[model samples]
Target: MQSCFFSTSRTTNDGSNETDQEGSNKLSKDKSIKKNLLHENIYTIPNFLTFTRLVSAPVVGYWVLQGNYTDASILFGIACVTDGLDGWIARRFNMQSIVGTIIDPMADKTLMTILTVTLAMQSLIPIPIAGIILGRDAGLILASFYYRYISLPEPKTFKRYWDFSIPSAEVRPTMISKVNTAIQMGYICLSLLAPVFDFTGHIGLDYLGYTCAATTIWSGASYVYTKDAVRILHPPSNIKK
Candidate 1:
């Protein structure tokens, strides 16, 4: 009877060990799945279109500096078309992605920055207007960096910081922000084409510039006051309960 009791205790201990091993394995699998969900597929047609704009921005800047307005205008027009098309395609086809949200504005800002700087250098865009546009964008960019850092999960290394696949925050542009971007793009487009058409000193362009400035300031303020402008996808581990 004593030997039988010892044998029964041994079996119970073995069963408990198996249960512990199963729990550990399940926990490990859950972590792996969670990590996989963090990384999204960033390659899509919309992304490709947005990428094209990023590539074209510098070329447009070079042309503007070189006084090659005709080709610059053509390429800029194409870039603008792709910009709208990509967004539409993304929505229509359910190809929306977190990376697209980041890069689309990035492409827009890159193009606008290059053109604004080059045009300002040539005295096409008023210095004050350029400053306003640049300043607003700079502030937003800095805010984006802050949001990204705070929203990122723990172990935030440099590699993870730059990894767009691991989306930390999603930016939702405000209504005024959308309007501001549209006005800014229109103003820039006209500025790019004015030289080609010999409308450099047109009073209408001046009015557009003033409108752009107003919208730019308004939109920047909207982002500041709007609580939902940037949504945190995954708060840092420290921030989590």
Candidate 2:
């Protein structure tokens, strides 16, 4: 009878041990799944809106270059609207992502670059002002590449580097940078529609150009001096030693 009692006790303990082990494995899997979800939540509504801006950029530029000002103005208006809407949605609905930080500015820069060049080609904006805007964007683009490379995690291959899901850095636009972007956008939108309203040679447009140039310079300098403009989340594997 004692032997039977001992055997029963051993069987019960073995079953309990197996149950505990399974529970631990299940918990670990759950934690891993949650971590991945938090790491790569890129398909949010704000991101989609931002994507629309990207797609609209080249179309707006094409229309501008083809002398389709009315269509270009309409598309530019839509782009501007999406630009503001995306940021608002991101803030309002808590759908912000690291990818949003990277691509939002990217879309803005792309639009600015295309329009700046096209408008310059048409002599809508002063050549010097266009050069200033393009130059500042060029410098910022170079800095972004360097920061991204240095902040990326181990095995920084081309694919992973472009894979924004593996976010390694966050870009917090400086106050001056934000103002500069708004001013720049307004200037570009007005430039696109100037022909429609016969406002091409207005003195106000020249004043706007001067303001845009000043803000462009100030904002570029702000990025240089601002300590927390770019935050590196992961130290590069190259310097892991």
Candidate 3:
């Protein structure tokens, strides 16, 4: 009688195992469908705006190199405005993506690199200044790669005013970056207006350019340093939490 009871229990367990396998298959199929749908919707409106800014970089560079400062300044301003707008739209509409975060900053860096190098070559800004800015930018890029390889965890929150003030943990861009960008744009606009309005005599374009360059170097350094601090403060061990 005991043997017969054990045989019945074994059959019951096998039936339950088959039911679980069937449920798991259905769940996996549902997840695959959802992933495909998400992949198709990656290109949101905010991302489109970012791509537009990336595309405008070369056009602005061309205008500036041709001595068309006014057009270049106008286009530069438009691109800057779009950068802000893209972030706002993404957050407002819940359209943010990992791709957008990566692409948006890359676009800004590429635009700044092109403009800064072109300006330096044209003698609008000093080469040393461009070198410093470029070096800092390059360092940040390398640091990013390092962080990824080490599997750095993301911050719980984006608000870090104290962290922004420090040079080492400034991995995240702050309002200072926006101000630096604005000053650079102003320098470019003033350089264009100097020939037309004879403002070079009153306010030299070279001086303005130098100021912008100084700020760029300072901000870039701050960012790189702060990022390092942040990494140290919250190392890989904290990732498990």
Cα TM-score per model: 0.86, 0.85, 0.65
Better of 1 and 3 by lDDT: 1
* Candidate 1 lDDT for residue 8: 30
lDDT at 197, model 2: 90
Those runs of model 3 whose alpha carbons end farther than 4 Å from true positions after fitting are 1-41, 148-171, 201-207, 227-241
Per-residue lDDT of candidate 1, residues 1-241 (tens digit)? 4775443323355456555666689878777667666878888999999999999999999999999999999999999999999999999999999989999999999999999999999899999999999999999999999998998876788999999998889999999999999999999999999999999979999999999999999999999899999998863353222
Candidate 1 collision pairs: none
Residue 233 displacement in candidate 3 (angstroms): 16
Q: Total clashing residue pairs per candidate?
A: 0, 0, 9
Model 3, range 5-97, lDDT digits (tens) per residue?
A: 442322245466555566689878767754442233546899899999999999988987898877887888899899999999999999866
Ranking by lDDT: 1, 2, 3
Alpha-carbon lDDT, every model:
0.91, 0.88, 0.66
lDDT of 2 by residue, 1-241 (tens): 4765443322255456555666689878777754564367898998998888998989988988899999999888888888889989899999888889999999999999999999999989999999999999999999999999998876779998888887888999999999999899989889988998999979998999999999999999999999999998853333321
Q: At residue 226, what lDDT does model 2 achieve?
A: 99
Among residues 3 or more apart in sequence or in different chains, the pairs in candidate 3 whose N, CA or C atoms overlap within 3 Å are: 167-225, 167-226, 168-225, 168-226, 168-227, 169-226, 169-227, 170-226, 170-227
**Poorest stretch of ten by lDDT in candidate 1:** 5-14
TM-score of 2: 0.85
Residue 21, model 1: Cα distance from true site in angstroms: 9.8
